[model samples]
Target: MDTCTSFKGYGRVDELEEAAFKRKTRNQKIILSISLVLFLVLIIGVVAGTLVHRKNNNNADEVPAAAINSAEAVKSVCSVTLYPDSCLTSLSASNTTDPEKIFQFSLLVVMNSLEMVSSTFPKKFINRADDPEVKEALKVCETVLHDAVDSLDDCISSIDGNQISISKITDLRTWLSTVITDQETCFDALEEVNAALVTEVRHLMKNSTEFASNSLAIVSKFLKTVEENNIPIHRRLLEAKHGSPSWLTAAHRRILQVGKPKPNVTVANDGSGDVRTINEAVGRIQNKSERIFVIYVKAGEYVENVVLSKYQWNVMIYGDGKAATVISGRRSNGTGYATFVTATFVAMGRGFMARDISFKNDAGPQNNQAVAFRSGSDKSIFYRCSFEAFQDTLYAHSNRQFYRECDVTGTVDFIFGNSASVFQDCKILPRQPLPNQFVTITAQGKTDPNQNTGISIQRCEMSPLDNLTASTFLGRPWKNFSTTVILQTNIGGFLNPLGWLQWQASDPPSTISYGEYANAGPGSNTSRRVQWAGYKPSLTAAEASKFNVESFIQGTSWLNGTNVAFDST
Candidate 1:
């Protein structure tokens, strides 16, 4: 009985020990939960504080603010440089009066460089951008730059000022720099988010030097103009420089000097230091300069084609004489349609002047179409020149031009164009190949009534080259309202009794204005000529003055050195 009681007591002791152990474990678990919760709360507070501090610091970084400020400053500078009429007035108030031209000359350099950058670098960069927004923004910036340049061009063309200061030009330079800088900043803001943006930004930076160099060159030219204007004799001398005894040949030689002439530039046929092929000499000239380049050619047959780029200006090509020196091209209709009309000499450069040079497309009658000279230049002049061809010859494409003392020969409508041109003292030769092959002088003109484009032949001579004779007309209207005039000219017997040809049976007579003023020759019998509604044989002196060289060629500024007589009668 005693042993059984001891066993019960032990069991009770074991149960109480197990219960105490369980209680200790519960207390430990509760303490662990409370400590873990407190640690988590502290971690959350620290993380939130860090985030807020970073946000504040980012906002305080005022580089973005400064960029905006700089942009505004740039805008202000541009307004001062271009917007204020007072600046133009102040510059013109001085004794010198060619600020507008000087500014234009300087700005052309900047524009040309910018064009190169925009065409080359910007295209590559835009295609490589990954972010849509960033790419669009860059495109927008480029567009803005282009638009700004165009606006600047317009402003320069219209601005009437003389002698702009270097400081004022510097302001423009700053504005252009700011435009590039701002674009760079935009790229930077996007770069971290968009890794691809680096290419565009890098391109901008790389090309910025070229842009800056162009700007610097422009500023330098402006300064030079101002300094030149300050010198009284220098300005007058430049304005009043007279033509030399061999002015016609000298002018062309000067034009060829614009390019880097070959080291061994040999005039193959002459003792009078002059080039043979103008193109060979043109290789030596620099782009975008105001200096006049003259190329002289001695009497010889130069079988080559020549092209004058738009960048080349104040260029002149002269020969020993039209009869002696011939620039000839043999490409004809057999040489593809393009080659058929390929000119022996193409004058595309603005302010291009040539004299005493016989430009010939020597492609014979069997060759079909051949162009001797093609000119699409504004303010262009061809004095004492000759254009010889069998088919299509003179391709006067666009702009206002003057050809005085020239001999032009062709079978078809040789002088074809959509430009305002006046041919004075020019010999018009019509070569007849077949009996019915009618000689048409002009084919195209201003289709729009608003456009001022037409051909005015003043004091010209019309003659036949071959024994074969056919009815020749003044011109056939290629486009609507084809305007042509034959004023005080000697019309050859080869001219058809009818003055003009009707391309189609029912041409808009109102559209074309084919007229003649006191034309004298065997073919100038007005009584037997075409009784077309548009033909007017008699004209007053005031009416004929419109076709004069001075008015048509804008010769007041460019003809300063020339002594050519104007066809006033």
Candidate 2:
């Protein structure tokens, strides 16, 4: 009945103890709350300020004395994150009580650091590096670093001041999250080409990565603070009282509400409505403040790429289902494009929502990595969307991203990235593998333990297509400390008994956090699963909850507003 299933008694959980556990948890929370208040008070007043003058206001921007009084508190907060030294150094100058200002100033510190390092890339890397292959990789790294800097600048600018709207804060978090991914991407590229070059690159770029990580940690804190403090914040979320949004009459007065969606623009192929291409419409949209700009694409196969940049937020692109609406391209890693750069449709904006659309790259598996849909959008959502490709289909690049009721089809490392993302009730289809080859569903790239990043698939269905009996596995680690969880999902029997593959045969990633809980189907057996240090057969109920949408991506709080019907439980 079992293929050498590992001993379960080591971490086996007792269900009857759950009642006592709840009582203990409540007692702990009370004790911790009282202790934190006193500890937070001790961290004030270790301060400095870099003031900027305001044209309209009489006063200059300065750190509040109250924040200075709580200096140790700030450091305590930083201590809980990944890079304490980086967080403390970057945010040392601005000691502000306002969470928004803390977020803004923390981002500014990283932005400046990235800018400084990016300026040196050309001379220090591209020209100085003797190896041609190394120089080429540096060029890609330089571009990505510059993009990260741009994303940081966008995050800082989006926060007008301390008291901005919740949507803006979400934007800030989204971009900061993207910056983390951008930094990781550079590292991934270098490591793939020559792992030896990593030490040199890390020496020069590790500070930037640390700073970006700090910014992400700070934003996460701010979001939690706001939620906990019961601060009245106006978040421009589109929630339908009736679950998924239904078509309302044009005469409805709610359409004119402050943050309601604007009139949709149309796109058609044969001389119709507003525009001929997706880019044309995307180019015309001025930042509509918080109002969502909906682009209704007509039923046609539009053969062009689309991008929603950091400056373009709250945009919705929908179409007439996957069969009729298709956006495709043929760019691939083999054709001089990095895997990240080859995505046919890229979303880097905040609050980006798409539904009933199909994004494809027809370059086939022969082209190496050809991405169909790549997203670094924070709080971004895709519902009933289809991502089609052969090798690399969808790059959930970074941030708190979610995909519900979507179809993702590919051959190798298809649904991959370094993001804390959730895929709920989606179809994960693996294509036919070549003779003597096998299929891998995911290639998670989490490198840092501090990152709240992992690929969590809950209630998702994984199946094979065509004559795909070659063999299949759940995933392989794309980097050290990689984490992925498959819970309450149905797996097809086409999968190999071993269940997972390792990128490094001689030195497998012992820190890989691979696990499956309550998964039902023929392939869900853990009998022959790898006996890695980090692989868990069944997570404790508490541990599994941490991987749920509520804990992993905190989707329960914001997913309702995405207009995508998701299982809240």
Candidate 3:
């Protein structure tokens, strides 16, 4: 009986051991499956990281070239045409009335303007190139640009004035640097798209290439035009051979240069380099001087009120640069003066000349009306002068005047009157809180147009202190026969599309003559201009003949000096 019981226990122990082994095998299999999944996940993560890094690197590589190219293209197109070259006519041509220099300088400015339009092509194209077609088109743009560059080189080599002054060379070098940067920017942007471009992109590229081509052609044609129109070098040489303006004979035998100071007069206020105060000087001078009476003012500021009688004929005031000499007053409508017509400098004399000085009214915008300078005098001339105020800056009461290289700034009717006036190479700066109503240039001559009364702005620049909004007008007729013309001037983009505004709807058709001719700049768009019944859209050659310097003001009498030859053209 004891042997049979021991055999049963041994069998039970073996069965338990087999069960344990089977359970261990199942657990091992489950562990192996989890380990396999973890390995796969790590491999996937590494692949994804590598792909992201490569894509970022590619994007970075394309960025600089694209940015550079785009910028260069835009800058080259929109650059100024009439800056440094035109500057030659401003200071260096001080007493030089040579027509050739003036014309050449003017034409050079036009050529320089071609750069402004060229810069926008690349950017416009890039912005439009989101389609597959644009991308395809752009793929071959670099080749075309390279060809264009080659053509430019040929043109440069063909030009005779290839060797310019150091300053000119420096300007060209700066321009080249900018061009290179723009070109690289464009290239980089194109590279960023790589081969994954869409149809829209291809189309945009095509358009851009075409635009670039067209712009380059325009530049080429402009260069040829410049070469052809340049008054021949031989003509300049011949002009030099002729005696200078100093040796030219005058039509009249009158003394051109004013004589030195009188021994009787003693200088009191040396601050203004004057022998006497403006009031004292005017008080002393008699109206009967047969020769021209000139007061040569050295560089200083004169703050006083002045008035000249009608008998003070052939009077002249000359100074240093406008910034160096100033004639200022704070008189306004309700302030110091009893009347709004009270001006800082008032002249009723004929043949009055003022050069290189500032006449300012410092009564802030709060003053409704302030007269900076008033000219009741006929045949008045202002050269390199400035008229500054918030309102009613210049009042050319009832005569004729000429302003050359003058700066006129104000908010309302700054340059207004019944006089015939011509402003050449002047700067018209408008003030803030005003856009369409900034310029009220004329109250007009109630007398007659045949009597020679109008306002002409030639080769001037218009600027606004406020932000540009497309709704400004040139002038409004304050009275019937209000006439104003902007000829060969640069109008600012702040101008509204409509060129004129009616003071009121009741202001009828036969009242004014507002004319613009051959004007350029973003503001001079004729397509959207107002078609008012009174405004003359074009000036005929015969009608325009009335607006020359000699006729506008009787400048022939007083513009000559030892070193200065006044330009009548």
Candidate 4:
């Protein structure tokens, strides 16, 4: 009986194996058949799309084969972007098929949409809202939308017809990125004011933002193609022993390095310099000057708001020391001021540089959202400066900014903005917040993935000012695609082991890119960091290199002129 059972079991096993083999063969055949069908369908769809595109153009006979290929290329480029439909719609009216021309057309669409939004936003929402605060926020929206339009105009002007250089692309990306930030900032202000028309305003602005995003995507694809093909073009990568900006000439570098450069204008509270106040010195500036217009402020506490207007270009302001020369204000959102207007020092001009100065907003933590220093200046540099406040201490608001050996202190979102900013050899201090308020170090606002903007905190130190702190985190995402990296920094023990916090009760979207590489100190431990989909506790050297000065901000080309120290690697 045992022998008969063993034989029967062997027979059954053989039969089961034969059945499994047959099923595997049948599945493979089905997969092959489906794959072949899908391939045929894809070919048919491409051919049909091309034919339809030709018919829409109305003159297929006049259209060259290159034009046909160009049409297909446009479809291919749009296919890979996040909003293919929007991209196609924006490019549909373009008569030229050149990728560069298509990108230009996309920018034109963005500019037109933004212009429409700028014109319609005020009429649609400002009068509808009865609250003064809401109206103020709406006004802020109008201002930013106008700024966006102006930036787009500048971008369009910079492009020499259809030809766009890599450097030009870089600048275009920066400007477009700011456009996205400006739109989101409007929404943020409206949300803060609790405007009832916030949703409507957002809806009105959605298409413009989407068009801008598509333009960014299209340009990025163009850039990638250029690089991959090794197409020779006008490219400038500034290489110098020390760091500087494009406009910083060798003479300027010498003066800055010598540390005793003669000032074009001077400011002092006492009757010792050319002017009694910084603003007075600013007023004397030659609008859009190409040379470095130097202003030396003697050591004193100037309790006045200083603004470097957009018309003032290549202005360099330095002081005796961060501790001795102080600019202080008390503007805060709690005091009915919009966050955009709350900065004690507002730098809006291009090539604005400040060294050894202290910007302070003394509104206290109770006032909420006080900004000490706000920079919208492109290619701006802050060296050995200090920003002090209880919240939003340093608003690196927009553009390419670099901060070296600076000190920033705040209770919440101390270092925040949408700029492609890097902080090297700086100190980030978090002060005690109001009861039950948590401390967050950085809140980077990168609304679009192609923005080429992020907060790269390299070789910095993060420590708390007061003891017995509540939960502290590295940062919370201010936008969906916010990007930040803490590389080779020293974190204090006060930071929560989780290392990062969500923006609200729910976890931030997976688009937020938070990375920490080769950080030291107790808080740098990744064993218990937040398990969010986008949080990267450990990154390899190659991955971290992308956030460095050279790759991140194209710093090598521009920093050679600033005479500031930077690490390209």
Candidate 5:
């Protein structure tokens, strides 16, 4: 108390100390408040960061591992295609890892794109076309594009939810290949009529064609993977060792196997049968009939154009003989008809069979690009038939076709098309050509390397129908990857020393897969054959077998029911 009371002039010493203490307590409170505010800020930051991390983890977990894996797998699948970028972009939206599903998506993408093209094509070009030829070609494009769309529809239906059966794949490849052919046919028609429009039309259809090509590649890869991995699939559609197609009922097989099955309908010029013309017989057929409808075309010269449309299925038409029963027409490209529409007998139905029949286009060499027998028939068989014309005699137009003991006679491109066709023990007779026009035996139109299409003349005879002053060639590559293999066949001496010819005057394209294996006769000599990059003068036996019936068309699976003789090896 005495120390506190000392030397207090302005104020008491106790009061001064108490005032200093109050000021110090105020400063401490301010410091405490600042620290509390900082701690609260730190807590809020830590909580926010933790919530963000948890949310990020949750978002990643929402994407299943399978989806990530599938996306990667899709990338891998698309990587091997010719149009990888297109393939990837098309399949980007697909979310499944199943290869089959991926393949189905590819097909759907192609289908949608094609449908768009088909719809817009007519609207874009057909109405504006001025030339009659151009207009006709556009119309033809419209038809073929529609047909292509239908084939794609069939393909999608075949694989929508079903396991990829061997038969289903075969059908799919055939139809898809046909779609490619249809696309090219449009171009070919346009090229013939108005070359100026080709570039534009092709530009318009570029996406569709590329998508189709990618789908084909993916399908082929899928098949290869399934086969290599020994994956079990529905094999019921696979060919039995000695039986017909599994879809054929016992009664149908019996009827097909018979030497002279009773006819469901008949055609005769002299009123011996039910109908007088082949068109009438075709008209009576049930649309898309599962059962084989038999038509007995008796002996007569029927001067008519017969078309078995795609809606008509499994039709078997037989005649007395090639000479006795003749269906003749005179349509030709020179007569203002497109080469495709100039066909005398057009077969567009699947499983179409003709026995002992004759199809003729009387439009001679003057009528360029006349087609006698145009077959878009899948798994079709022509036995003991004859196709006679000046140009494009046997238009093996598309799909899997087999010719056994038939006669195909023409001057230029006698046997031509994009079908995976095999001719066994048939006569490829090259008649006289127009002045300065050399003869080309085959013009395989394999526009894409992935297309499983070619002309396989196996165990056949290629000779001149008459004295040939003009030179002859085994084939000319019509498209980039045109494939024509003349294997184990006889060639006449009239063929030029050069086994093959160029499609144009330029150097032959190296992309063509032309081969001659174990072929006999003078024209088969490879010493003077064109030394193109793609021409294989002498193919090994192993390579030659790839063009056989079993390997080429998978014929064993479907040919058994037809009762037609074929060499599987």
Candidate 6:
């Protein structure tokens, strides 16, 4: 599937005018200035980091160095973290130096607190819940609380050892962050049903949130200590077996059968189906459906923009194929629209799936930032999809998403966002950027250090389109702690020797979690890449597996429903 030879498939848009790129430098000046600054070294700050850590005796909360490894374990670790008071109140000394135990206990407190809140829900809320919608929402909360507890348990298992790798701790932090989100999820559902009820639940979950926040603070302290001491971790997760036939079940097969499952609804411009437009069909969808709703889109050129928001649960959309089914828009950030709002197609719901569909934004390079697909999807999967645009094509915006066998074409920051997403066996086509500037494939936007979000490209192919003359780099950190990994991927010669880009000057390149593992091809030579603080040319096999489909997004559990064959190995 070397996509370099032809541009005919997947609704080629590269044939757009070159004049749009000829004088593009000035157009992007403001964005480059704001989004990225020139890399400058703060010599004093770097030097200060090398000095010995000190406890501020003036501060009442600061723990003394002598108490670090003693019975005051929580206080010692709390001193370095942002939320020391929360840590002190929730955790106590057991094994001061054993970070895993400290973290496990902090999360245990969170789980236990949440469990206590749930115990009262059955006795107080359920009987009083008069609305069926409220009752359904409560059921949703019950399951979400259970899942949050399980996430905490997994975090404990992840960091059970006395000494664990930085990666494992990162995983633990990631899972812990998800626990916080789960509480928000429950509250979101409950608020939709009865906003008045949410205040009570919030009060109940307050301590649990504080405990989780404390655990994350402790983890952040460990990260800082590791950086200060230049410590290295030597552990990784065991790789799971791949290539099993059991993923595609009879349920999946039955749904995929030609014309037999028939669409629950169909959208056709010719009025051949029940609906004349995509929105009409989407409007007919039941809110918060318990069953999968399938929509068939007839072959046509749809010029209207469509948004599939959060309430459309378990909805699936499939079409004739990328070339045959086209949905295009021309919204751009230059037109005073924010990048997030300038998307032609948006999917914000959980349990959303799409196949054989093409999302395109025809705005040229001069349009600044135009997005084809913006996804705030959770446990969502896309197969055989095509995302076409000149810039910011696929906005893997938030939560978890999986794109397999998809084609994404663009120039600057095309595949960018903060979602914990994986693009497996997909084609990332790098087109030419506006003149003078080189191409930067990814721009990960992770605002919070404790967020369990990153962009993982696994076993994918990176190719250069016809006009991509200058070398392109892998990615630049849109945020200080942005995480992105290119694993077992094929990089074309067009990639720059210094395999990554930077948002701006003075951005600490070392704080980013950028790495490449077991990658091959012309652009993968580690010698030429940026020698940043956290850049790893190659990750160990076990470490690489931690970012694979299974561990990254737990892809195995949900991807099966898509009926799409994936490389599980």
TM-score of each: 0.54, 0.74, 0.50, 0.84, 0.83, 0.62
Evaluate model 3: give its lDDT.
0.51
lDDT of 6 by residue, 1-569 (tens): 22222111221113232343333323334322322111111222322332233333444465554444433445555554445676677676444534446667777777788778767774477679887666666775775576567667767766566445434555566566666655655675576555478888787787877777677766655544443443322112223222111222333334544432478999898889889888888888887676778889989988878888667777788888888888889987666455556789888666677788899998788888899998866667787789999878998866677777789998888898777888777888999878876677898866456666788887789888676786588888887678899987898888888888777875445678888997889887889778788778887776676566655664222222232333333
Candidate 1 global Cα RMSD = 34.8
Off by over 4 Å in 3: 1-276, 336-340, 433-450, 465-471, 551-569
C-alpha-based local distance difference test score of model 1: 0.55
Considering every candidate listed, which one attains the maximal TM-score?
4
* Ranking of all predicted structures according to TM-score, beginning with the best and ending with the worst: 4, 5, 2, 6, 1, 3
Off by over 4 Å in 5: 1-67, 226-259, 555-569
Error of 3 at 568 (Å): 14
| The 10-residue segment with the lowest total lDDT in model 2 | 1-10
lDDT by residue (1-569, candidate 5, tens digit) is 00111111222225544465455445434443443344334334444554456557855455555555566657766865899988888898888655567778899899999999999886578788788888889888998899999999999988766755455666787788889899999999999986598998899999999999988886665455444443332233212222222233345445544666799998998888897888888888999888889999998899998889998998998888899989999999999999989998999988888888899999888979889899998878787799999888889999888777788898788888899988877888987888998888888999877788999877688888998889888889988989989877888899899878898888667788889887888778889889899989998876776677666776222322243223233
Number of clashing pairs per prediction, in order: 24, 11, 53, 11, 0, 8
- Report the poorest 10 consecutive residues by lDDT, candidate 1: 1-10
Q: Residue-wise lDDT of candidate 3 within 280-366, one digit each (tens)?
A: 666666784545666666667778888886678767676666788778788776453432234788876666777667888887767
- Candidate 3 lDDT at 18 equals 46
User: Which scores better on lDDT, 3 or 5?
Assistant: 5
Q: How many clashes show up in model 5?
A: 0
CA RMSD for every model? 34.8, 11.4, 36.2, 17.0, 28.0, 16.0
| Tens digit per residue, CA lDDT, model 2, 124-237 | 766667776566667768867877887777777676554454344455665676677787788777765674768877887778888888777765664565446543221222
Which has the better TM-score: candidate 2, or candidate 6? 2
